[model samples]
Target chain A: MTEKDFELAGIRTVEEQPLRAKRKWYKEYPVVSMLFLGIMIVECFFCEQIMTVNPTYMDLEHCNVAPGRKFLFGTDTLGRDIFSMIWYGGRVSLLIGFVATAISTAIGVLFGAVSGVASPRADAFLMRAVEIVLSIPNLLMIVLLQAVLGGAGVIGISIVIGITGWMSIAKVVRTEVRQIRNSEYVIASKCMGGSFWHILWRHFLPNFWPSIMFMVVMNVRTAIVAESTLSFMGIGLPLEIVSWGSMLALSQQALMTGSWWMILIPGCFLIVTLMCVTDIGNSLRRDSNQRQSNL
Target chain B: MSEILIDVQNVTHHFKLNRKTAICAVDQVSFQIKKGEILGLVGESGAGKSTLARCIMNLYQPTAGRILYKGIDTCDRRQFKEHKKMLQTKRQLIFQDSTSSINQRMKAVDIIAEPLRINHVHTPRGSARAEAEFQLHYVGMDAGCLDKYPPELSGGERQRIAIARALSMEPELLVADEPIASLDVSIQAQIINLFKHLQKEHGFTFLFISHDLAMVEYLCDRVGVMYQGRLVELAPTRDLFSNPQHPYTRTLLSAIPLPDPKRERNRRKGVYDAQKS
Candidate 1:
């Protein structure tokens, strides 16, 4: 125990080596998805400059033209450039996805937070209502609501999808909020006399935000899919207003004439965008699960 | 005699599992804490020590009886509302686990300043941050930990931050529910000493709940022993150690292991018989 015994033992201090923080490059950041999504957004943003011809300008002479250097992605049945149409319609598709997701996430977060903080009886009633809404198929509800709303424009379809899509996110958020509401920090904040809004903003949001994020991104994909499905059924936005959905809707005539590019190009774009979105959402869910397990 | 700061009269709490079943956690427990004294509550796990503490902190409304803080009935909603600010600012709680007690996303300084911000207590120490820094130093922590989050700190450091946060409000009564239970032995002693020193200097009432009998003996002005949701013995620290009244108290006292090997070899562990008692 003494210094003399230590000297006899020949104990020496080694300089401690600092560990470099392990940067989880793959799991922490979905680089490939982000890059793809970014490129898509940029391409849509510069649609006007990138298009070689007007997206909606119909030329009778070039009807049913096959894909060639003169007409990239070929001309559709009405002779509009499919390449230009994809970019132009992409803007509307992404816009619908984002706006619809925003609306649904907002409604869902608000509903879930209220349910989580409500009394047991009120919470039960609210959750039962959500369950009832969830019992119906999402696509059926969206389609029914879209039909009722008359599918007037992009905004109308977005609203219809948003209203129908919020049930799932609300359920997810309510579970997260219920779990977080019991956490000691939230209780401590309450004991300190923090108001409901104060606790929600300062404590609850930070604790439950990661869990809600995955559902939000997934909602975006769901919204886009809903728009496409409605349009494919010939009940979505009018054909005059160009969107990926409306483009696909117009492909019915192209299908009869054997113009394959009309159906193939738009479907690929939609599927790729959806896959990237799903990948990002999966990564976020993984990140949140890891965080919860660590805790 | 010192004036009583907290008065619990026949307080009882029950957790209802279903329509036909309920678990009585605290059964008609009554106790009084005087001003500026450290009262220790000790019992085995599941003995309703935490339930009693929560009831006292107004975190749970007892199924029966009531608690009075400075002659104000805290259970009454109207009375609590009337004195909400004073009740909130004048009392604070330190939970057993600092990891969950403190917000992980917040900085140490912000955690310490939160109560002040919430209660709108004008910081006579200039700013809330300055007051927080003063409290940190008072709890024997350096200003270097000001910006660090709870996850970045060690166990002892996190507990210290939790202590600093509770002390920042300068509450008249601080209820620490097994504050040292999750800490290492060495850190436990350090925190115990810190509590002792702080009590002597600040002259604030404390309700310290712990299962460590030796610690209760060393640091408390008085000790209350609990068993099976009931108070078995309550007495001065010296009297309780010198002469325990209840059979359960004797059993608890006898369970403290001695440091001397020869004497420890001859030590007999006492067992309690519920039927006989």
Candidate 2:
């Protein structure tokens, strides 16, 4: 018989109308999309303020200016606008955090899924390697790597964080892959003479989506915090780049002189941004849990 | 003399526990199912009936012996791949727990249409949804079920949907592995009767594996008794029940509590054994 004539006699099909209804919630939430849109808009409009500020423009004339029409949210000892510094500083921090998290999560999911689904012998070997990497304190490993790399720019620090951050996500994804590989539908696909690659892409990946999503959101927050810590320690992006971490670092000397704007503005921005991300991540996690429980 | 649809010869399957020892799940079991015949494989939980079914479906490979489908040897790996689509189209399995067997994430129509899509059966002419609905109606379900997931349906309804999925492929043979064993006892008869009605209308062979001999006796044309990886007896259903050759078969028959208290009391007294002799 022609390929078209071979009916896989027992597989069921869904009617179009109901499938749309079943998938309605994914479209309705749009939380991730909204966050992404908000980030893009802020980045495009507010990134110019950091470059415009003359860090050495010691405006002794307007130093320590309180919240006023001329200088909104007051001026630092160096006479930079607190509001302007926050908007610009936020751009680099968010960029590094998201990029690092994306890189780490992608590496983790791919490696974990492959190792988990590979032959048992291969899986054992890969898992041992993962365990070794995980045994090292993550922060120490990133610090050591940054020291060795030396040029510790934004890209360099991001690479260091990305490499260290993937270990935990790999472990989670490996566990998920092991569980999904044994599902009946996967076995059924193998029985139907599907290729290994086909099964991996079609069955394994789709089933791994929920876990991958959870890992991605969790890792983004981790990356943001890790970037801040590194920057505070003088190992993150170039000293010239006005990131949240660099802002915090610059504010330290001024703190003794009690120019609170140096520390308070960047600190508050970091807290608010982290809170927003955490809220969205927690909501996604809750939704995933609810969907699983309902199933 | 019906045409032979499936011929399983000396199929001995073993699962390796280690280098030295193996679990003999199905040991040299042989049977032939004829077109339109319902061959009941009655056994206890560990009797290897399901393993034999899996081997026939190519889900599990037999360590030795061959399964011949319509005179073609199916045990050859190359031949199996070459004829994979044909095998799937010609043979299907209905698992015991309808809810677990059907994908919970999939809607009823997509579950039914999966086999058709996989085998590329719905060429240019028929829509998967239309074919799914037709098969659902064939198993006494309606269009409403198409929109629902497996979790949303009652046990009987889910089983019906499973049956519809199996029937959609238009297979010549179906391996129904304890299809109704998970349903409510009240719904068991309805599902059993539905299988019977479908067999009558579709004229497909069935290898019905179950521990319930009474249901098997009512539904099967021939019956095979399996005990601890061995087929102890194989005969026409009437002959097997009325004149059971295997001790296990006799035990199964005697254990069926008669509906009448008087008859049941007499059966307890070994009166049925005497009558059988």
Task: Give DockQ for candidates 1 onward, in order.
Answer: 0.50, 0.16
Q: Write the per-residue lDDT of candidate 1 for residues B122-150, one digit (tens) a residue.
A: 98798998998999999889999999989
lDDT of candidate 2 over B47-164, digit per residue (tens): 8999999999988889999999998788998887788778877888888887667666678887787777667786342899999988888888889889997889899998888788
Tens digits of lDDT, candidate 1, A249-277: 87889889998999999999999999999
For candidate 2, write residues A58-100 as lDDT tens digits: 5677777766787776777666666666666676777778889
Q: Tell me the deviation in Å of residue A192 in model 2.
A: 4.0
Q: Which has the greatest TM-score?
A: 1
Query: Against the unseen true structure, what C-alpha lDDT does each candidate score?
Result: 0.89, 0.80
* C-alpha RMSD of each candidate structure in angstroms: 6.4, 12.5
